[model samples]
Target: METAPVPAFSELISGTQRSAVHLEMRDVYDPGSRRFASWRSGHRENPANRDEWWNPFHSVIAEAVARGVQVRRARVVSEPVSDYVQFEYDVTFSNIAAGEQVRWLPRRRASDLALPGNDFWVFDGRLVRLSHFGGNGEFVQDEMTENPAVVKLCVEAFERVWERAVDHHDYRPA
Candidate 1:
C-alpha cells in the first residue's frame, strides 16, 4: 500500500492559529544543503546580506509571526557541539531577525526529559510533523499526525525543553 504524502511544513505553519513550536534534537542535519556546505567551508551568513540567504521557509515564519502566530524553536544539543551545530548557532540570528524565538538546551540538561525520537513541529497544539533523516544527515521523509495523544506528547516535550533551554541571545556554544 502506498503511503500518503506528508504535508508541506509551510502549509502546516500557515494553517496554525496561535502558535508553532519546533523541536530540533539533532546535532547535524541536511549536510547536502547549500547553507550547511557553505558553513562547512568557513563561509558564514552575513547579516547585511539577509536577502541573499533568506528563503521561503523564512518567509513562512515571518508571515506567521506577523499574523500573531508565535513561532518558537528549541534545540537540544550536546556540549562541545558538532561543527554543524556550531554553524547552526552562528546562523540562528537570521531566524531571530525573522521573528522566531529560539532557545538552546544542552543535551545533559535534557537527560530527565522525555523527548520524541525524531525532530518535530507542533502546530497550534493540534498537529505534529515529525522529520526523519538519514545517518549522514540527509532528508528522508516527514511523518504527520493529528492524533491527540501524539500531539500532546510533542507539546509537552517541547514545553519541557523550552523551559530548561537558554535564550539564543544568551547561549554560548561550548
Candidate 2:
C-alpha cells in the first residue's frame, strides 16, 4: 500500500537538498505603514494605537532574505506574466526545492485586520496549509491542507486581488 505524503510548510521552504529558500510576499498594499486600528475596526474602538507597531510581514521577510531567503514580490494582476497563480506556486516549490523559506500574505476584505485567512503556507510554491487570523492575533480557522484542489481555489482568490493591486514596494511610510 502506498502512503499519502504528509504536507509540511517547512518542507516547501527548505527545497529538496536544503540549499536555497524562496519566498513570495503577496499583499494588496505595502503593510509597513498600515495601522492595526485602521485595519481592524475593533482596535479602532479601543484605540490603543501603539504607534511604533511594525508589521511582522516586512521585517520578518527582510530578516529571512538577509539570512539568504530568495524573495520575490508580485501582484495578482501583473501582466506580461498572467500566471500569477503558477508563479506563486513555482516560487514556493522552487524555494522549497532549494531548502529555502517561503511566506505569503494575501489580503481579504474583512472587518478584522488581524484575520488569519489573510495568510497561507505554500510548499515550494504549492499550497500546503490554509489559515485564518482573528481579531485577537489568533488563528481563527485552520484546516490541515496539502490538497491540490483546495490550494488552487485559495491561490485563485489571491491572484484576483493581486491583479488589482499596485506593487508592494511603491509605498513609503511617512
Candidate 3:
C-alpha cells in the first residue's frame, strides 16, 4: 500500500507550538550536498554572508523562537568527528543565531540512552517527523507519526541526550 507524502520540515515546524526538539544521531549526512562540497574545499560559512547561506530552515527556527516556541537540537556524534560532522560544527553558529539551542553529544556518552534508530524532530511533545536516509546519506523519506508511545520514546531519548550534550558554543571538534 502506498503512504501519504511527508510534509516538508518547514511546514511541520510552521505548525508547531510550545516546543520543537531535533535529535540527530548521524555522523555523516548529505555527502553529495553542495554545501558539503564547499566545506570539503575549505570554504566556510561566514555569518556575515547571511544572504548567501540563510535558508528557510533557519528562518523557521527564528520565527518559532520569536513566537515563544523553544527550539532545540541535539546531535550524537562520534569523537574524532567525521569531516561532515566537523563541517556541521563549523557552521552551527548560524543555527544558534537562528535561535536554536544546539548541543553536541559524544557518541560514547549516549551508550546508556535508548535512542531511535533514525533521526527525528519532535514537535510540541506530540508529533514526530522521523527522517530516513539511504546508506550513502541521501534523503530517503520522512515518516510523520503522532503515536503517543512513539512520541514519548523520542521525547525521552532526546532529553537524555540533551542533558549530557555539550552546548554548541562550548563544543570543540575532537
RMSD of each: 2.0, 12.3, 1.8
Model 1: per-residue Cα lDDT at residue 113: 96
Worst 10 residues of 1 by lDDT: 1-10
- Model 2 per-residue lDDT tens digits across residues 82-121: 2333333322333333233333333232222222234554
- Candidates sorted by lDDT, descending order? 1, 3, 2
TM-score for each model: 0.95, 0.37, 0.95
Any runs in candidate 2 off by more than 4 Å, and if so which?
1-11, 16-118, 140-142, 172-174
Put down candidate 1 lDDT per residue, 1-174, tens digits, no spaces. 122367888888888989999999998898778888888888878988978788888899999999999999999999999989999999998899889999999999999999899999988898788899998888899888888878889999999999999999999999
Model 3: residues with Cα > 4 Å off, grouped in runs: 1-5
Residue 33 miss distance in model 3 (angstroms) = 0.6
Q: Which pairs clash inside model 1?
A: none
